[model samples]
Target: MSDSQHHNEEEQAKIRTSRALAALTIAANAQISVEDACASVVDESGDEGLDAIGITLARGEIYVVQAKASSGSPSPTEVLKFNQGIRYLLDWDWDSLGGKTQKRRGEIEAASEDDVKVIAIFSHFGAQKTDEAATKLSDKLLSEVNSSGNILDFQYQGLRENHDNRNIASGLGLPDYDLVFERWITMNDYRSEIMGVVTGDQLARMVDSFNERLFDKNIRAVLKATDTNKILDATLERSPQDFWYYNNGITIVSNSISCARTSPRTADETFKLQGLSVVNGAQTCGALGRALRENAPLEDVRVTVRVMSKEGHSEDFTKKVTRYTNTQNQVTNREFVSLDPYQQELSESLLSEQIQYSFRTGQTLDYDEHAFAFDLEEATRALACLTGVDNATRAKREIGRMWSDITANPYRELFPRNLHPATMYNAVQFRRVFDERYMASSRWMDTRSGGIIKNSTYMACALFMQKARNEKLDFSDIDLDVESWVSSKGADIYGLAAIVVELHENENPGGFPMSFFKNRQKIEEFARKVRTRFQETGS
Candidate 1:
């Protein structure tokens, strides 16, 4: 091969690697799967100035990347090309772009114009401090994009070395802070905590450098600007100097924290914190970064961060701290479950029994090892049924409200101190069976019929399980017979449920109220009638 051809191939390989790294960074930052990130990428060939595109479904935002793997700063022309690419994306000028870009446009066209658009420029060579012309070009492009009445943001990330990419790939890794100033201080009744303060610029750099991985351990979901966030933004805007006084410091929990104080003369210290994650004040941190990016007077802002060492601390203890620190907002039952010691014990027990149990929301369960794992939310719903909560079947439809109910009253009784993990496990398995059998039946096609059938079937399954437990029968031993019974009697059961639904609808012609189902007495009466009919048919 010619020398020039070999060099071109080498450059292409580098570009491919950089693009893949960029994709991983996007996935890590967005908290999405790599496959999803890859799906959003626009082909490099005939690519209209954009290297890749990533869409965050949860945040309703799109990220367009322009990555350069060169050993030096990206040229002014390269910056201009990046700018032009964003323009094309914003203007929806698909005709001027390649098919892949056009396809991406179509994928995101359903998103509202108000959705956020972030243009990220990634470079192996540092884009900070050097490349003044490139910075100017970026500013010009951002101004143009912002003037178009779109919620747009521009971020320049310079990964100075290959190790930088590796750091980003690890979801919990910290960005390269400008100056790590660490100090040891003892709190009352606790081991000394490592306190560090970073300037607003450094915080902004960290936010721009990494993804949501920083706040991965936080209990609360990513919040949009709330009253609290607004207050934080205002404080940063008006009195950035008093930021430390005005704001409660951020709390971070990590497995280990290390610091090297090189010189007594210099206050700067090099700190390496491993398995680090922000447990509290995620919104505050996010707002600070936003304020700095939006030209808030944050250059002098010094934010204090409290780092608690996770050494000698149990995972449950760390989770408890995380849960307590986030009590300013209404903590969900699922969040509570995640911190409950009993829940952790149950999860471990289930794991030992070859059954997966996820006490945390959004935790992935390996279905191959275990038939299924119940997330706290799903487990709560099943518990609601087992405890005889009115309209327990409605938990499937209104999961959020059901959680609130589960945390209170008759529903909460289901999670008594001495409650066995087997009861909860069996309830989940029964619900899964009901769901599978009901959905598979031909009766599921009709919307009205399907709704009634679902509620009745759940009631039937719950009653059967309760009866089995009362009689001290092996629940799994009767699984085959139960499945057969449900399969055969599904139509008859639905027919009875349909009659009940029709009666309720006729009684209140002004649309059937959900209160009708909330009547436990009425549902029990229907369930008894269905059971009697099934018994007569069997005899």
Candidate 2:
């Protein structure tokens, strides 16, 4: 072959590799394999304008991908091409399509009529333009499809700098395990499902073994260390038998499920599950894990399990089951937390001081009570700061993860049983005060300059608590004179905010302001500065 032909082939190979790598990154998110994706050389050869088009064998969902390796920003034409390809799939114009796409036409056509999830992927090596003309076209396509009563997500993987395809399946999947699902009762009313009980011991062991992956199919991420999760732990510890009746059991969606032959009536059914996901009861699962960590007794604990066998064919059906089971009259974690006596006690304590603490999800504060009303999250914020700089950083990071460990290190440190409600009230009032005075005084907080100072609020509250401790403030006494405390600590707060903001903006900080807040060393350094300032000013 001529040198020109050889060079042309090499260039073509580069383009193919680049596009395939980009496509695979997005395909990975759909749990689609590289073998499953369009890694073929002539992916863009089709007049259909898509680089890749195929359905996931596991989910029966379509993936229409458009990829390009660019030195600069990806052109608007790429999005238009992607749009053309999606429209082709919608219409199934087989006669004009390429050989590879045509081969998959039967699968595409089968899924076209159904309300399937079409992951419209646009993978590129160039920088993304969220509001560019191309982006507008992409958004238009997604909006058009989503509005048409289908779940269409445009997965954009803009691989600007890195070209590494090695991390494609870095997150492969949850393990397939065989668990004994107790006394399975086949549900005749619902198609392809079985109801059974899962012991807390077995569930806890699964959580310990699998961790977060066990809840991968769940609509919600593993909500660890929430009040609801803590409540579950408490239930298991207190009355494990009552848990089955009190708790709404978990729902599972399995890739494949096969029961052992002829188990006796009382015998636990041994089901071999190839792949599975807990579609509901993420809180229960997470709490079970926490319970195991705390060594909470799970002796008599049993949770009901309803498994919807996906079997690949029923992917659409399983999707609907995951949706309705999770959304239909769902008892929110907030509701479960509200049942905890600590919440009611805290509510009553705060109410006595003319502050309404809304703990439940649907519970609303009166318009008149807006000044004094705060929700569970707000209280967490205040308590987080009051716990001092270390726990404050954890709260800044993820307070939800800290709030549930009431029996242990983090939250137990904050809300010790003997810890006065007065202390909590004071901290909350101080939070409101700081928020009202220094934090919300200006409109520029959304700006770059203000964003720096905006992140200093938590630190400010923490510094105030530290000062209160140094001064030996009355914790047991319910003092309604929050304004007095605020008046005393106002200077310290302003000083801390100014100092922290200056340190962040002027000094070469590690990361973003929010990230800097989450950093322990950074938080400690800033706290030290604030403490030094407090000493100098003699507050």
Candidate 3:
């Protein structure tokens, strides 16, 4: 092939890879399926700086992605391209663009700018360059977006970024072998806990080696530098000697830990940990690594490290430890589920009944290990359905709102005191069936009108399932009936959903009404009217 052809092929490959990665990230972060994520992505190939475009359904946020598959950092030209794309998006410029770009632009224009959260993601497969030109370009773009009064968030991910990290069979660039410690001190009875001091150089090496794997179990994503991080950086710069006392230390989890102590009585020892990972203190560790890369003076800096073996610990227990250690920092309420004894018991009960249950979001349970597992968001929606919440399905997509309700409501009342494992399983299964049925109409549902109508459809389906199973139906019976009903009347049900969507839109033209999904009486009355209409049609 000619050189031009080769370059084109390379760019095409990057586009394909970046789109796939962006879809996966959306699915994992949004707790949706890979297929759903792909469906949301709009193709705008010739739209200059835009590569992959997706809108997060739950949060009503738009994600504009620019992906570079190169091993080197994105160039100044790439940054300018991204800047131009954002300008077009914000300025509502479409006449200068191609048909596909204009079409996508129209869809975005339908939503009010205030309601939309625009996230610009620049992804590459190597470390991002922070040289003068690149940095200046980035600052200019960021400043323009900031001054535009738009809710725009910029995220840059490189090969070392956690967006690419996952615990898969193929091992997505995670390091192999154990991280060794030259001198350590045991802190527990079973030799599972060890505490020691690590030099700044050693800390940087570990971060470079493990990268995103260090935060495998963390509930939150790796955040940008905040005011807290600034303080830590200043401390590291000025008082390297006081670093150990100022910092809370790092916590790590591993499959096993082996120690070869240099002395019998002294605290000095050499420790080697296998399958090691930092479950907590990701920000602190990340900051230290960045500082070291910038050539910070830290030869004498000694940061405390705690390593715990997961040999005797259940996954649930390990997660709890991570949750507790991270409490000093800002985290989502969902992260605190590990501290709930009822959640732990619920997980255990489900396991005993041969069902896999994960209380945390973004966790993948192998089907071979268990019969069924529900994502936390899915389970939350089911609970909402079972309890007669009007827009219960909406809770599945709204993490902050869901967290608020979860913390405010009594656990016994929100989740029944004597909840049966089978019932919980059935609720999740019912929601899954409903989702599958609705998604089958994706050809229409992927359109703007269809997308607006989708959430109401989900709520309606959940209500339908609840009403069907009201008479103490068995799990198998409920599943069969739901499947049959969906197969026969799915289209009519979706039509009803579209009607509900119209009603809401007409009532509140600015956005979806807050009362639309919250009022139990209103929702049930709408459902009754839909049922009456279905009966009258008698198809």
Candidate 4:
């Protein structure tokens, strides 16, 4: 054969192998079909940086994938190019990517910006180098960002040719099983109406069969070595009997549910269930699986289960049940408010304006979930500032009080159902400027004036709003970037600083400003003094 012909053939083979490896790697990581993964791959000529990318539906995180079909792992240059590609995407430099990738701008933008993953995968030939390469990449990325908790990280994988992707091809394999529930009670049309206890042995059997796919569709459901899982591991290892009370149990949504027809089925001892998928309690299952793998003895451990059959329910309603039921126990109060219709509506409205509204504690971002975005925590602080001086003080001193009982007074009054979305946008924009300009940059000095302004941030914002409205400053706009109406009000926008400094000095002489800001009586006096200044400045 001619040398040119041999070289061309070799080049073609390399391209084919690389594309094949890309499909397999994405399928393995995302648990999607190889067909879908192949379709998402960027095969354009100039696209040397990224090979393929996808978003995880469960966590709403964007995962960028790079595949190397050569021996002994992808070279350092390939890794650097992959990192550069991700940086380009994050910076929104769409023109630098291929045409197909640029067309996906909207979908890419919609995914979680605050949390992204870049997976670097190699051919099975590189299996021996995978672990060491993965560790070095992780360490290098952390060092580059100077943050262990950064929004981006590297994950390395070696795709074995012998392994079957069939199970995972079906997407997070919770294979059709006759789910057995003990002492079950009937609740609706699909059968045993939805309450039961699942035995530990049953979970053991399922874990043995399903592996990591057991927790698909769960909220924020990536099972790692989290502190929550650590507690679960300890409990399962040492105290199996008390597991039921400590664990929040699992909530399942079945494609269909059934039971034996022997007598009235409501009081049955157990029954058959097909297509059972857990929407919550992934941590419990993971911990139990870990314990069993280590040969830890388990006794009298049963998980309380609630099943929401998808027979007649709307898609949105079923999703709501899943999101609400899946929250970590400590954040349940804040997370539960996500079920409120108003919060969802407001969230939708804010999206067009580029502001990410986070009503749920575990909510994935809509626009930008990072610090610059208008988030729920800052929104609450802004609302408290506008609500009254007392609320402002409480908001700074103890913000958790607002979210402690979402259905009750302080939370309800601050985020009433009647509250309009525009008002929230305006308030958030107003307070966000203060936080970013002063608090975030540590622009405040240890001097008394700096201390006063920094400590009384929320209260000062509240008073600023009052004075601005009297001066007729507009507050109805909601454009996040191109138009932050509140922040653009010129030098006079910070006219409240002089008033705040004077108020703090006059009301709490010789006292620490932090203590003064948190004190209700002192804040009330400060607000009164600011109002008096606003009125008397007519001179």
Sorted on TM-score, highest at the top, how do the candidates line up? 2, 4, 3, 1
Candidate 4 residue lDDT tens string, 12-61: 77767766666666666665545667767764555656777755533324
lDDT against the true structure, per candidate, is: 0.59, 0.64, 0.59, 0.62
The residue-by-residue lDDT of candidate 1 on 1-539, one tens digit each, is: 12224457777677666667667656655554456666666646556668678764335366777666665667788788877776556545566666777776656554422225564654445544547788788877665545423456766666554356456455434432323653334363122256657666666556545445556435435444343555666678878888878677778777666655332212455556666667887767777767756767667888777777778777686687788887764344346555557778878877777779887766888888885577776787677676653546445334444434445654457567777777678777666766676455525444443444444555655655554466564444413344454455456444545454554344422221232343465556655655565455542
Evaluation by lDDT, superior candidate among 1 and 2? 2
Q: Which stretches of candidate 3 lie over 4 Å from their true place?
A: 1-331, 360-364, 389-397, 400-413, 470-492, 501-505, 508-539
C-alpha TM-scores of all predictions: 0.38, 0.50, 0.40, 0.47
Q: Is candidate 1 or candidate 3 better by TM-score?
A: 3
Sort the predicted structures by lDDT, highest score first. 2, 4, 3, 1
> Of models 1 and 4, which has the larger TM-score?
4
Which pairs clash inside model 2? 225-404
Error of 1 at 442 (Å): 38
Residue-wise C-alpha lDDT for candidate 2, range 1-539, written one tens digit per residue = 12224457778676656566545654465444344444432264554566766453223256666666664555677677767766555545465567767776665655543324677766666665543787788777766544424456676666632344346345446557676866777755223577888788888887666543456444542353344565676788888789999888888887877755654244476776667777888878866766787688886888988877775465486667767776766553435456557778888877877878887887887759544777877777888888888877777765655655445667667767776777777778777877776675334333443555666677777887777777777645675576677776656666656666666654432223444555677678767876786677666
Best by TM-score: 2
C-alpha RMSD values across all candidates: 16.2, 14.7, 14.9, 14.0
lDDT of 4: 0.62
